[model samples]
Target chain A: MKDRGLPARISCGPEGSNMQYGFVTIYWRDMIRFVRFKTLLISSLLQPALWLAFFGIAMASNFDAMMAGMPVPAGIHSVGYLTFMAAGIIAMTTLFTSLFGGIVILFDKNWGLMREILASPVGRNHIIVGIALSGVTKSFIQALIIMGFGVLIGAAFFAGYAPLQIVIGILGILAFVALFALGFLFLSAAIAISMESPEGLQGVMTLLTMPIFFASNALYPIDSFPEILRVISLYNPMTMLINGIRYFAIGPDFYALGHHYAFTQMDIALSFLGLVVFSVIMFVLAWWRFRKAVVT
Target chain B: MVQPGPAGDDPIILVENLEHTYGNFKAVDGISFAVKRGEIFSFLGPNGAGKSTAINILITLLTIQKGRAVVAGYDVATEPQRVRESIGIVFQDITLDRDMTVWEQLEFHGRLYDMPVKDRRDRIEELLKLVQLEAKRNELTKRLSGGMKRRLEIARGLMTRPTVLFLDEPTIGLDPQTRMRMWEYIKGVNREGTTIFLTTHYMDEADQLSDRISIIDHGKIIISGTSGELKNTLGRDLIHLETDNNEKAITLLEHLPSVREITVRDTLIVLMVNEDGTRVLPGIIDTLRDAGIEISSINLKKPSMDDVFVFYTGKDIRDEGQGPARPHFLRAGGK
Candidate 1:
């Protein structure tokens, strides 16, 4: 090591003055990492588009013929399956992306970077909230990409709505997506903290995400399921979230296919409020688990 | 640079009855010590002797469950932010972000502490130069060698220019040359008025560097003093005498004022001497001859730090197999 006669002191003006500095530093660190990897950005955008291309079209092709034999429900029709699946896929993308967002924290824990951050002068709340905010931003951006791709493929279901209604719809979708993303981000963080190794976390992610995705109404209407599964889907938060997205973005009349429940304003509000409460609970749980894990 | 007072007045770090537990086991059992400003103090122990746990508590990484720890004038439990601001820590485990460049890692740490942009740049440049890592500033940290990564960690720890620095096993797996170079950098940093709290199992490193040393074992401090003082706890010199008749030599030399203890093994009579074993060698030779015992060869050996460790802990620090309590996720000795 050579001596370059660098200044000895590093000025850190006051104790509480730079509290926000920790938040900005953490947020920028995640964003810079996100931007630096072109492959990550490309891959994230590509997965949902492929799901829309393969799954959306495959289901749409069979729906008209399939509905000809069976009666169309009161609020849904066979022709609108493509539009319905598009909205559902957007919710699924937000759900999956946010669920895995805490992989960053898992890496930090294993590599000891989390310990470094925990030992710093920064407030613990800032660390958790900063990561959650970044997850929300990433999910929101990806949701927009899905919408753009859907319109590019000539779905144009959103084209029918007025500009103001579109703005209102996007706000509702953003609110629902943000809450949903935060809930899963906290869930992932909670699991990552208790986990000793990344392999354990990986197993949990695989086991949980599939059941969470399939059991909900992201791919099908809850009423179409068997009795037991119908009860499970009715209470599954993801089902409520998908229902909220359909009401706001796709309009109330096109809410579900062969569904038993009516799409009322009360239902939409309750779904949105349910997610908010879930997010807060998970956030508190994650913060508590984080404190216990880092100490040991 | 504040000039600290004598050893007992206002230590930079003060701990009293600190305790920590893991389930039913007490990892740190009510330990207390003080470190003066600008002094290099070390806690020497084997792998699971609670050195890292105590350090974790002092640096505010772990909350103290049953005692008080004050670092740089703030209580570790109540004023963790203040404690964190006053100290910098280099963990025993590697904590660098592999994807980041060396410069980027330092910049991020500086930003976390809220340094002004130009000051952060200047400090990073100086630190890179200090660690001799200027050329590797733009290279990803994962590409650096084990030694280089250790140096980068040190540079990052110093980015905030903390009042006190805690280094946990700073030279655990480095090559000899790198270890020596790191010592030079550490001494240089200390000379510039930073109080250093170091922990390591390397006896010679502690012996060579620390002004005060504390030997901890089984969650309790067995002994604490300077290296010389600890060595003196055993006799100052060891005398090995090869004789034709060992029993007679032991009988004749057991009463000598200079000798502390005498034991016979095979054809050799080993004597623990207090001081000037060489000056008393002729007297012993004459006495052995008068007693009709032939002295073949005589040798005097000064005690090393290993002997000091053995004197206090009853086992060599490096020789004891690691305990089951310290479970490393990554393999040890892999850097």
Candidate 2:
């Protein structure tokens, strides 16, 4: 509905030399598109908001001892467990949104729109970056909104933490988003070119989302579970992600780190590096896979 | 529709011994051809004739498994990005986001190519008008008719004003009138000197347009030439005489020197003529008359692109596609 006046020329390169053009504008234009698609936009937010409101409140009473062992200055978990759940759940929203957001990539393939994009003169990285940014921005917004909802409900957050926690939370969320974006984006392109039905996209999302969700600590802490479950949870990428959020949200505590190492910048840096390594590997794979997907 | 010039000038596209293999099936067997700049080249084949595969290869949608493909003088394999830059492709499947409007769709693509925003805006408006879709510019694409969606695809394909355009089964499932409307727009684009390359199975569509065509079957280009050139190369004008029994007619025409080939096709003894049709008509009439066969009807059909296809490959083009041929039918009477 806004005035879309004469568009500015987004030169692919300097003038002369039969320069190619138009890639940057499409990327920017897609950001506006992220706002227009209501169903897709809301679906990202709805999942987390639901978990925060209904599940967090309903399940908190059950998580009492789970919180009692938290070993905060408070003697028992009490309401603090629910609070811990709230912060962790909000971060998990980013995981769910960005990972499965690759479903959109598959949708693009099935409809043959990816062909239109790839056929253009635009650089492949430009397209990849644009979609990644949108997916991250969508997840980040939902994460923040969920955070607010959590506080409003008296989520029992263990506060008095330093302001630096914001950096940790944001960096952690962005890193997780980048890693999932790269990983699932590759998978989406792979599934897309081969996909014959809309069901194929759904089937793939179903296959991926569950493993990543239950294997992580968003729903519960790692130590409460059995030995095998604890090992699996510790190794799970989302486990590390939720731990990062947990440490930042609740100051150093025994519940998350199993010791006083809770607020260390070291853990944040390690998690960030791990996610970055995963991101780079996935990115290279996606770049190669997409190049193959487009040409095939 | 005729142009007077040497035919061998720098062809806008060139493919040499191009081949693709998906396991044991050779979808495109070593085939070579070229299209002159500004010529409307059509790849006419039944559904599985690998027409789509070839289009994919040319547009850089599929990789060439063997040999080489060059478009606008850029090697598709070695310099695919450049090849992508030079061509615009409209796939048979509707690829536009149903959630995005016509204007938004074009703008997103403009940014993909990093068009100077100015050029992108001007091009979008020009194309919206070109497709006669300026009125629906802000409307969601989901509301568009089958024909309108196709027109949007053409507009989308041309947003970058690609030097070469690849349309794979553009009109697959529209009503007759809409099909014709699509053809009209396609012709207009071709007239504007866009080197148009498309693939379709509709017999009439192939005959109606296409300055040149390549007939592919099971991944091999069995034949390639202008429609007339390919038709004339069949070396037979069909003579359909009203014969109650085709076997008797085939036997009669088989021994005749002027008759080149005869086949019982479509309940008619289709006779191929080696002699000039004008000269041989009376003699054939006299011969049939003496046989006590009353002439119920007589018709001659210079081979259509369909005939050229049937002559080279022993199958119809429409049998193709796990994809529904529905969209192709939309263009049937559209032209």
Summed over model 1, clashes come to 0
lDDT of 1 at B264: 48
Across A191-279, the per-residue lDDT of candidate 2 in tens digits comes to 55446677867787678778778877777655667888788776666766666666555554544323233446777667666666666
- TM-score of structure candidate 1: 0.88
Tens digits of lDDT, candidate 2, B137-201: 99998999999999999988887788998888888998899999999999999888899998888
What TM-score would each prediction reach against the true structure? 0.88, 0.83
DockQ of each: 0.37, 0.40
> Candidate 1: where is the Cα deviation over 4 Å?
A1-18, A68-79, A255-262, B1-9, B241-251, B262-270, B285-298, B321-335
Error of 1 at A76 (Å): 7.8
Real A-B contacts recovered, model 2: 0.73
